[model samples]
Target: MSDGGDEGDDAESDDASAGTTHALRPLRTDLAPVVEAVEATGADAFVAVGDRFDDDLRYLTRFSGPDRPYALVVVPDGASGDDRENGADVGRAVCCAPALFDEQARREFVAGARARGDGEDDDPGDGEDPGDETNAHDGVAREVRTENVGDHAGERAAAAVAELVDGSDTDHTLLVPSSVPHDAAVYLERAGNELSSTDAVTAARARKTDAELDRLRRAQRATAAGMARAETVLADGEAGEDEAGRPVLRWEGAPLTTERLRREVNAALAARGVRDAGNTVIGAGPSAADLHYVGDEPVRPGETVLLDISPRGPDGYYGDMTRTFVVDGDGGWERRAYVAVESARETALAEVEPGVPAKTVHGEAAAELAAYGFDPNAGEGETGFTHGTGHGVGVSLHESPSLTGAGELRPGHVVTVEPGVYGPDVGGVRLEDLVVVTDDGYEILAEYPFGIVPEKRG
Candidate 1:
């Protein structure tokens, strides 16, 4: 095989800057409580059904590649989900897209079947009868998969389960996804008996094992470098087109397209040596107010741009951070909005910690807005400010230990602290940083770039 890495022709990878290692913390093996609960139900095997959740899938399979079409994770009891660390990977495994289940209870039913089929009964004469259907704790093995019954996103998941796990005994409990679509819930009501859902499995996945922490750290380093490059691009005043059909830009080379910037950002990160995280939002002016504005319009002179980037750590631990900059010489509204967002961002970051309520953290941000002449509950500002403070960032882009009004911030949770304001005529400004809840306070995971500035000559 081509004699290893070929020493003499050492190509200039130049990507040494793309950070290595990750930040997965430790895997929280606390699902024993839930496992015990299911076991208490006399279910032999616990089936795991799911939505298109990455963490949920990783809960069973340390899934690395993204190209499977109809994947279903099957695990045996006295195995994972029951014991931590070493229970034997003694379960059947597969990864495919056309998964089972359109809803939860149906998924529960599927679990019943999968667990039964996956149990010791595989010996055929292992002293376990195949037709006895009335035992819950006797010999029921728990299993999980996905299903959908309606036309909505999870309908197919619900349907997939309903089709496979119909008419099982009441002792055979099947789990339904609590995040199931409202329409799908209506259909899951037909399980002949009652059904239930478990809280987010992220809690089961968040506390990363030593290996996961390494992947997350690597992702953050890559993100910080990407941010640095973007700052350079903005400072150089790269421009192209504006909404009013005006051509007012000078590119690094060819015409500057939003698509080009996104592509460049990913390519730059890959060159640095990390798995490309994906696109970044290079929103200008009013577009920044949209929150998730994908960079579609070209950069225009004198516009406010919010550069928000999130790259998933290897093993899928995610990090999110944002900053605001002016493309060209900006106006008054831009300055005020930018400053307000910056102030809010700092205050929010300062308040994150172990015991603080997530709602309290949000209130701290609102207090800053009120000081800036905007109502805390008044919603979007007339001048520019809009949106909530921030959200959790970990295994999933948005997960637990959230900072929303309804959330209760806890230790081990990582979240974004962002605040911004937007103006159509001018642009918008937002400053965001990913912070981890620590024993005392919080840990900011982003490197600060120079403050936002107006356009400067290249």
Candidate 2:
């Protein structure tokens, strides 16, 4: 966990506005690595198109535009005569945004690139400076430019892609991500461009930069606040009866339910400048065993309530965490499952280091669960460890370098180490923590207590 200091202070300060607060650190998105990967594919240009839901496109361009298609095109630096004369090794990055989003895109993508001096010159152009409009030919891209295309985002983006590789004498081959929209692919192909799919962007996103790590840490802390709010409510709750005179946990003069707890958690998250993105999973009683449950079942005094909240921050980064809580407990199967899951979480986290195979982490967690008399390979509907150990978390809630994937852990990789045990008999127990693989080991983003009994926070 991060030591309480400037980082902690910055995370708690809600004074900064959305989007602007996280810009304190410049993004270290070097396109050099991407260029190398693209070159290996023998593609004349790379193009990606999507609306706001496209995390890969957002990572490539850093343009958080409205829910309409925008495009990012990358070509070899010297592919065009203009770039060759400029003497750039890195490729060119062009953002094709709708007219309504032109200025916003320029501010987010072009301005940031200029501030980082990723371009050829360091001078952040004054109105009169001729070099102010020059392309960034160094770090993130050889040059970053934006075009205010008309209404058709996909068509315009395709046209931009065609123009970017038009200089090639041979049939230009365009490399597109596997998730590219069918319409965009059709447009590119109809424009006489050959389309080939590549995973370069996904691979790049697996390893994050320092700025991303900072954003993730802030997000996780906010998530912890949300969890604390739910826990606080449960802690302060008192025994009561429901409409039918059944035992229930009541808070604020009402029976506590999953829906009520979820609202509390989401409100806390919003207060901290993050949105729940409708991913707040609060399951009580038998509903807890059904992962991703979002119903309004009453929470009782002795049943497990699984709280899996993965909220998205203002800067587009996600924070994922899961904790199970039981209010005044009898400590039956719930306690045993909690202990096993916690141990499995620790075992998985211990194996998170640079160069360790990602699958090894899952295997170790499974082994630990099995040692505790829980079968990791239990039948589909049977109780035991059900899901994989964890997954990579970033711009998208789920990304690459998965715990079950055949890739090795890298220093900059941020992933979730979650081990869960589910059973209909006593609900479900899950413990999850977000961690970043460091040079030698791993660092949990925030410090959150693990216990079946709810803990009150001041």
Top candidate, metric TM-score: 2
Tens-digit lDDT track for model 2 on 1-458? 33211123223333322333433365535555566666888777788889888888888777776587877777765544466456544566777766667567666666655533343333433343222424553433422334545545556656666666664334568888899998888877766778888888899999988878878887888888888889999999999999999999999999999999999999888887889999999999888988789889999999998999999985699999999998878888899999899888878877888999999999999999999999897664579988888999989999987999998999989999889888876698999888899898888887677778887853
After superposition, which runs of candidate 2 have C-alpha atoms over 4 Å from their true positions?
1-23, 79-87, 115-154, 166-170
Q: Which stretch of 10 consecutive residues in model 1 shows the poorest summed lDDT?
A: 1-10
Candidate 2 Cα deviation (angstroms), residue 14: 10
Top candidate on lDDT is 2
Task: Score candidate 1 by lDDT.
Answer: 0.52
Model 1, runs deviating above 4 Å: 1-16, 19-33, 37-45, 50-54, 65-170, 179-194, 200-202, 205-211, 238-247, 253-257, 273-279, 375-384, 454-458
Can you write out model 1's per-residue Cα lDDT over 1-458, one digit (the tens) per residue? 11111131111222235443322333322234344544455433223433435456544433333332223322224445444343333322222233332233222222223323454333222344322222322233333333322243233333434343442333324443354345445434442324456553545544444444455555665676666666666666555655566865556665455566566566756755555455477776567665677757666666666777787655567757677776555456677666676677767766776667787777788788778865456445344456767776666777665566564566566677777666555566777766666567766554455466733211
- Model 1 residue 131 CA deviation (Å) reads 28
